[model samples]
Target: MAAAFHVRSNSFPSRPHPQAVHVDEQLIRLRSSESASTTSSSCIGQRLCDLQDLYDSLEKLLRLPVTEQTIDKKAVDKLLDGSLRVLDFCNITKDALSQTKECLNEIQSILRRKRGDLSSEVKKYLASRRSLKKSFQKVLKSLKATDGDESLPVFGEAEALTISAFRSLFSFMSESTTPSGKWSLVSKLRNHKRVSCEAQTANEFSELDSAFQSFAENKSENPLKMEDVKRLESCVQDLGEGIESLFKSLMKYRVSLLNTFGH
Candidate 1:
């Protein structure tokens, strides 16, 4: 019996622990599902939740003595670097969401009072969005430049997925809500009709953009609607809450990894 048990244990010498295998499967499923569809706020939120779960699983896995010993110093170093980048991305995204929320709140307040020059407020908000887009572009360029190697082990794969998810989030945010080319107010009014028709098929960001665009183009005749402002405020609040949760998860995961491997 002893000899039979020894033979059976040696037979699975190279196989990963069951929990580790499960985590790998989770990663594969996440990557496959995300790749099969376009990015949306709902999808992004789901992905963040899934990633947080994965990180929690990984933290548990790292507690295993075999997992800790299996990971080399080089791999740990890679994880540390990747963790820093992930945190940076999370912070940038959070900042963007916060700034957007603040701007929308200001617009909402102005609309509620029906007193201020709504057009000027809309312009300020648009300008802030433009600045945000520029910042996202720069960060995205750097992300692409550094994304050449992703051959690390399980932890490396997780980091890559985190980066990819953030890239998609940033790309989605950077997209123009309005159509290309500058239009005269008359032209904008004409385009607004088409935008309205398409808004039903649009994402939250697009909906908010169309609302602001319509208001900007017709500020002389139509005041900024409170309903539109409220819709956008709600969207920002949802995104802020999701990102904040993911940020906390990422921080905890990074700290856990550092504690386990930083020696």
Candidate 2:
């Protein structure tokens, strides 16, 4: 276990690349699994390092005269080739990172626009809110039965409550030292006093609050609210829309995250 932890904390091994590009303005897109993370960033950092090493070595060689083949031509060629391979990997890493960033950005934009539709400053839309509540309830019900083709990660209840306050899913893949673990993402934390007995690893949508909270980004001290709508009706409508979109985004995120870690 300790060894696994060390592996998580350690950097990825620098892989070799062949026939690397020399362009300065190039950028790579990020993969969903790699976005908003130190793990992916570490790869980028290593690539930069390899590039710098190559530059330095070339500079030294330029200044030094060719006397009796310094350290054998073949060995030098191999070293240079290894460095070049790493450089190529770095380029690919950059592209993957960029793509992930773009995907996250797109998801955010959709939510933002939907949020914009919720800016009416009134609070008495219980009817509309209730309608949305029902829609989500139905969605949850279906999920509870495992009524269709699917799998689910039911984070036990206690941990979810913590998520409610924080509004962010902690990345085990990025932070975890090991590649494997039994509780990669716990559904709940049981030690807390407020957590209910029913917060066990249930399959129902009763887990919604905690389950949903795990995917939220970091929450500030002040909670988010709606703003800028022509009427309270639109605000209410937008609220439902925004929430629906949120559910969609989270579902997507969960899948992407699993796929990433699975790889």
Best by TM-score: 1
RMSD of 1: 9.4
lDDT of 2 by residue, 1-263 (tens): 22211111233224311211211111111122123332221232222222233333333322222211222344334333433433332343233334333433433354467553211211222222234345435434443453232211111111122122111111211121222212111111111112112212221111222222332333333233222111222222222232333333333433432333332
For every candidate, C-alpha RMSD to the true structure in Å: 9.4, 20.2
lDDT winner among the candidates? 1
- Off-target runs (Cα >4 Å) in candidate 2 are 1-54, 66-69, 115-213, 216-263
Query: TM-scores, in order shown?
Result: 0.82, 0.28
Error of 1 at 184 (Å): 31
Query: Candidate 2: lDDT over CA atoms?
Result: 0.26
True-structure Cα RMSD, model 2: 20.2
223 Cα displacement, candidate 1 (Å) = 4.0
Q: Please give the TM-score that candidate 1 achieves against the real structure.
A: 0.82
Model 1 residue 171 distance off true place after TM-score fit, in angstroms: 1.2
Per-residue lDDT of candidate 1, residues 1-263 (tens digit) = 12211211343357768877878777886687468554555555566666777887887877776666666676667677887888888889989989998888888788778777778888898889889989999999998999878345567778778888888788878777633332211112111121111112235565567767777888666656677667656656666666777777777877877888765
lDDT value, residue 152 of candidate 2: 13
